[model samples]
Target: MSNSPQKYKTEINFSNDWDISTQDKYIFQFFHQQLEDLEANQLHVHGVKLYKVESSIVVTAILRHSLPKKLLLEQVVLLVKNKDGKELAKKQFDMALFGELEPCTARPWKFLFEEADLLVPLDEIENEMDFEMAFEYYEKVISDFELYLDENWSNGLTVDQQGYVKNLVSSLEPIKVNEISIVGFHFEESEQAVNIFIIIRNAFSQALTIENLPIQLFDATGDIVCKLGFPIGEFQIASKQARPISLSFSKEVFQKENPDFSSWKIEMVPQTL
Candidate 1:
């Protein structure tokens, strides 16, 4: 439940249009294909990419082998999900079946979810062409990544990034919230806005209700840059089951006091219920 990945790495590619059931099947099919092509003791997926853009989820990973002539694989699977984890559609296939040749586009594995049924970029050459083999491997796997987003029609929740806070709530390991501050700041000479993001952990599982989650700015010497505070509205959670909440600030207010400020140190100024 902690945001920090206990496993080596896991990335999920998702689209908002499909329901969760369709998404589950897509996952099963995609993994099933990889299981088929993976060579004995040679398959690896220590580092992979997963994300959702619009209505589709795209997954990319690197697979290597101990042999010089090992077959390289690329897989592309399309996915769709609804607001509450419903799956609506899915498509998947391998590149080897496509005439055994890589697509000539700048991105070899190119499939726009809106345009085609599915997209798959994995290609295996019988022999190593040269020392530059890895470059081709990466290009094949990574280049068409943006297509995943360009094809879908719905805007889904950025679940993976937002879920990070949930992990903080589930942490069994102790975390030190060394510092937190929220303050106004100007970015790139643009409009003033909240320049800080503060995450306060309820590691003890005790309910914390702070009335004013202030907009704090820190100076070069680690001093408070401004006295202004954001009106963090009422918060509630009576017991240990509560999850951590987040606070947002305006950029202009933060940057006016500390132009260089990017982060903040927050403290719980206690208030009784």
Candidate 2:
């Protein structure tokens, strides 16, 4: 009892959001000498406790890294399952929130699996329970912006460029889910014409094909600059996806009362039935 391995900082050991009462603790499983994951991370599940607050199941465990060198992990998926390997709860976590792990060091942390996060209802659980927790790193977590790009663009994007786009998308308003929207982010103005780079999003739950689309361009000051329409027989788009496009407005069509090209938008003009 004299020797216990060094633990990580105590600040990460508990959560302020979990108002778990000490008297409400119930059935739990104790795990030790568990298996090492592919990333050399080992999880020894000390136990799990149940509390009435939010039907939350808080697991107390010691996470250790067996590798010879220090590891810095971020946005890691923590998967929890029963002994039979049926997934019970899953959540993505940033390691920094838990604390540091030097080579071969272990840290104890309490993970709160709230009722809303549980795949299986709490009423279905028996008084006795056991759990296994592991990390899933390969699974991709799509961002709000990543859902906007179609397959072609997602496959060809560079990491840096993709990150840049993701940041830009975060600052913009959430994309409407029921209507089709055209968002223009860039414009290339030449003496001959103004080429607008646009992203068209289909928020409908099913695939859509718009054969003809009439649009009106408006500048930052809310003045109409041009009106154009497209015969888009080939512009078939999948449900809940977006595609990048370019629309050119020739000088003759673009009414330039010295129209500001720095910031502009295009709106889809309603068609008469």
Candidate 3:
């Protein structure tokens, strides 16, 4: 009954608009219009180096918009919270946007996490872990922007530049405690049950004074065993500050609820400066 030749429809894949090199040229102008139309993009947490002992999240990313020329961005707001969504803390960081005329030229943003503002509770510091890095790009016009990864960046800075900035960063005052130690003890009555000792240090050169640090303890099954701390060592953690702190708890508590204490986390709240 059909006289016409058989026909087929073609499918097409769309690429991210922002990810392309040519897109950068016009991204700025687009951003300008966005500022007028949309609400300020709030990226919760700029740089987070938190541990799993505490339930926390970090928000960080590059917020950009393009048009014909001129790029514009404002500081992004980073927020952290507990599992219940109770706001733990927040930080605001300057937005960095890069535009390139060519594809492979040098266009790197040096990200320096404000070391001093991390306000994680002392109890959460008992576990071993690292901070989570999450970000949201608003007015996401281009598609491929997420693919832009810089393997060359280390500790939030370029490799070579990171090396050069090492001394400069070290010369700066104590930002926050960069390390934690956990010692273990075995009970003679129960060979399988071991009591863990914990010590958190603020090894910075300058003073890192903070208030209301929330430290929560988790069992092997990722349940909140105990949320400790209201009186977080209220003192100035001077640069190169290394001091011993304590956590008093029982292995039986963690062993009874969850045998998997091996996978624990501790997240500290970063301060807003």
Candidate 4:
């Protein structure tokens, strides 16, 4: 018979020490140990790729697992350093490696370091960049990776799917107002009705007048026990201020015989206007 070459590749065999319940935990621990070992040896530039886009730098790389077993990843921290051997910036990312990962698998990861993320100017990129050095040293840590620069690259901050870059902002900026919440609440029982006191805080700078606000009360079993609707009545709340409003409901409105007040929850129905 004529000799034939093998077409199928051999399956990877993992050692006994690599047994873990979830792939996320295993990958997290593996990367954590690798990073710790790199830091101990004063080499921090492995598994990282830097691309000098327009004014900002875009980093893209893959975190991989080579073991034969599937693993889970929870979170990982990336550190950026300057040419002076000084730490410049650090960011933590939540990994979505929840399910079982096949052997020799990889996950693509990207991070955008804007002007704010980088404390120093982009022109100052020098040979002392620790991330570059780390990548060179640990080239085998990741499989099939390459780095490229793009002058037309825009900031990845606006990308909603990339949650890691969403929080990258300046420290001096003020917190933006999104919505209002009930700060305090109380209830008083009278002979015929129950008084509901709701204290709301306006987080925005301008006055907010919500009309026909719907509030629902739920019992311990998550059943709607009572519903109340009232208008804010064109109330003007000053910038960064709080206001307390009171409403009353009939005692017969509650459907539960003996509702557990401690376990009850108040739900504010979302309104557009």
- Candidate that would win on lDDT: 2
Q: Ten residues in a row with the worst lDDT in model 2? A: 24-33
Instruction: Give the per-residue lDDT of model 4 (tens digit) for 1-273.
Output: 856532222222232343535664554445444442111112122334566777777764444454555656555556676545655545555545324446544443566666666756777754323453223121111111111112222232234622322222111123236555552245676777766655454556566666666777776688887877767666555544444566776768776666655555566776533
Q: Which model, 2 or 3, shows the larger lDDT?
A: 2
lDDT of 4 at 101: 48
- Candidate 1 regions exceeding 4 Å error are 1-157, 168-190, 203-210, 219-221, 241-258, 262-264, 268-273
Cα-based TM-score, every candidate:
0.28, 0.42, 0.26, 0.36
List the lowest-lDDT window of 10 residues for candidate 4.
138-147
lDDT of 2 by residue, 28-75 (tens): 112223423323434333334333344866666556565566655665
Residues 1-273, candidate 3: write the lDDT tens digits: 967543221111112323545554344334233332211222122222333323443332223222233334465445444444444445555654433212111121223333333456544432223333334343211111111112433335466644444433333332324432222221122444433322233443345674544455555577675554435456334444332233444444442454455655443323321
Query: Predictions ranked by TM-score, top down?
Result: 2, 4, 1, 3
Cα lDDT listed for each candidate = 0.35, 0.62, 0.36, 0.49
Each prediction's total of clashing residue pairs, residues at least 3 apart in sequence or on different chains, is 44, 0, 48, 9
Output the better candidate (3/4) by lDDT.
Answer: 4
lDDT of 3 at 272: 22
Off by over 4 Å in 4: 1-176, 255-257
Candidate 4, position 8, lDDT: 22
